[model samples]
Target: MARYNSWQNRSLIRAAEALTDAARWQDRGAFFGSIAATLNHLYWADALILARLMGNERPQDTITHSLTNPADWQDYRLLRRRRDRQIERWAADLKDAELSGTVVWYQAGGATRVTTSRALCAVQLFNHQTHHRGQVHAMLTAAGAKPDVTDLTSLG
Candidate 1:
């Protein structure tokens, strides 16, 4: 799943590179507003969720502001690419016992939230990325950028 997540992300980012700054930043009426914003949201979610998976502290407030303008796109792309590698390594090292363990995270209001299964938490991370990446794919295609095929069967 991590492999797929990383592949899809790379594909989307590569396609987004084909777009001009204006097109990348244009509002598409999606939840995150634009392709860049959607990608930033995915990166933000991944960072927070992976930190929880590794029993680490949350990331800083860089993403607490606007998602589209979270950071320079090129810089964020590099960071996200590195993060994807980390997630892949983590997934490869994951054990069955850890999958059944519980994970806890905090919400925006300092509310405590618990996930009964760590595996479910991992699943949710990929699911979250897929959901938003689908939006990005649609938006990219609408703007005539060619994102790679999302089918897992042929991806390998």
Candidate 2:
């Protein structure tokens, strides 16, 4: 699981770096309007799930609040690197017992629900990231920007 998470994080970072060209950032049709926005959303979503898994209060609003404008390539790169580190750290420290317990939390829509097993929740979080990242990838390709290889093996 840690290896898979690491691969996914590396893949995400590579995709972000591939969009360093300013022209790619300006493409309006892209997800979150640019690679930066899409990456920010991924970070936000990961943080949300991590917080919940650690028994922290879930944010009342959507993870979209963490979104920031990536007008500068350097700033966007720095933020993405920071987020990647955070995810890697979180994945490494996760224990089997923690991943096996139930996680009860309020949904963004204000409904209460309980999730069984940390592994399942972690899988859901990763899956959600991949799903949205796919949307961003398609948008990036449509706007004529080349994305990094998305295969998990290529992450290494």
Model 2, residue 140: distance off in Å is: 2.3
Summarize candidate 2's per-residue lDDT along 63-138 as a digit string, tens digits: 4445564556677667656766777788777776767767767777767765657677788877877777787667
Lowest lDDT 10-residue stretch of candidate 1: 57-66
CA lDDT scores, all candidates in order:
0.82, 0.65
Local error of candidate 1 at 7, Å?
A: 1.1
Clashing pairs in 1: none
User: What is candidate 1's lDDT per residue for 1-156, written digit by digit as tens?
Assistant: 889988998899899899888788899999888888888888878887888777753333333534854557788788888989999999999888888878776665455555547888888888888899999999999999999999998678
Per-residue error at 121 for model 1, in Å? 0.6
